[model samples]
Target: MDNNMLILSEGMHTSIQDLGRKGYRAFGVPISGAMDKYSAILANKLLNNDEKLPVMEMTLIGPKILFEDNSLIVLTGADMAPHINGEAIQMNFVYKVTTSDVLSFGNLKTGARTYLGVKGGFLTEEKLNSFSYYEGVTSKEKVQKGDRLKIASIEAGLNPSSSKIKVKSAHFKEKKLEVTKGPEFNRLTKKHRELLFSKEFKIDAHNNRMGYQLKNKFPPIKNGEIITSTTIPGTIQLTPSGKLIIMMRDCPTTGGYPRILQLTDIAINQLAQKKENDSFKFDLESSFDFLGRLVNRFKD
Candidate 1:
């Protein structure tokens, strides 16, 4: 029998995602992948799969899946109260499931997304060198009920020891996101700059894969719009009406709003776990220090 999992219910929003496409942003393609990359990687690592292997990313809620063959799996990010065959399972721990075993989830304990990783990863369709599903870029934007997702077959005789690693819960609970000054950071008035750091901004309901709109507003910049500057995930823009928008995974390649600050990669991952109405403060870091840390990370 083929190794596949039948999706009985597509809970909220679920999609197959990897590390995301590379070098396609030049063609106006947005990098759409798992919102919580750190958690996704952890899920794959627990199963001894490639860090970039595609996994099931579940948002808010999770799906109900029925296994058709024996497989190894792990769940990470957000305690959605996962259960297999009516038995609750622990997050971040590897488990083996046989055919006919059912997997499901309950209420969200914390965080906004959950990642499920198979032993050899899900065999989803790939485009532009990624399994990430994006509208107009992939055949399917998200998984739906009655879908049969193909998975790599696992060896029946293989028996791997269970993982003992424990990820810190701080990533999901962190409220201060680290950021660096953007190109137009110097154009802001001293009062505006102070407000940016001091004020606790609430995430507006206009939050999604594209970007997040903050509820707090600042004084409109002298020149609100830029010359259609390049933008990537983590670019925070300020609009003419004092609106703040933080670009996310699926944001456009270029934007006209004034770029006020750029979030670090760590901050981007941290912010991904946040949901609507969540409040957070900015922890600005000097450009020189941020650069030094980046260099050290690469050197290590």
Candidate 2:
């Protein structure tokens, strides 16, 4: 029998994603991929799969899948209570499943998104050289029930190797996000600059893949118009009305808001795991000073 993952039940928002497309954002393409890349890499690492392999990213809830053949699988990121054949499975570990075995998830324990990776990865066609699903780039933007997904062909008799890794608790813990001054950082008044660092911002209900609306009142910036500027994930823009919007993985290539702060890559990963209503402050860091700290943090 051909190896396939049949989607019996689709969750709130489940879609296939990889590292994301690059070199095309200049043409107005958003880089859509796994929101929590660290977790996605962990899932793929457990199965010894390629780092860029496309995996199913589940938001809030997860899906029920039926395996048509034996394969290795791993679940990471949010604890969604994944199970097989009614038996619970632990996260950050590799498991083997056979035909007729069913995978499912229950209530979310923490975090926002979950990633599921198979041994050979999901065999989905790539758009713009990336397996990520963007609305206009891919034929299917999100996975739905009754869809049968192909699994990359693997040789018979190959079994999954047992492997596990423990993730740090701080990755999901709500804490201060580190950010550096942006292009227009100096344009803000001293009082507004102080407020940006001192105030605790809550993620509004309008948060999504595009951007996060931070619900906090800060001193309004004087109206100033500039040429549209290039932006990527982690760019924090402040509007004239004193609203702060943090760009995410699917943010547009260019924006006109005053770019006031830019989150670090680590901060971006931290924000990706956060859901609505979560509050966090900013840890403003200087690029020169943050470099040594970032290097040492990753070195350990």
Deviation in Å, model 2, residue 35 alpha carbon: 0.6
Against the reference, the lDDT scores of all candidates come to 0.91, 0.88
The collision pairs in model 1 are none
Maximum-lDDT candidate: 1
Error of 1 at 229 (Å): 1.1
lDDT of 1 by residue, 172-272 (tens): 88989999988899989999999999999999999988899999877897988889989999999999999999999888999998898999878888888
Clashing pairs in 2: none
lDDT of 1: 0.91
lDDT, residue 250, model 2? 92
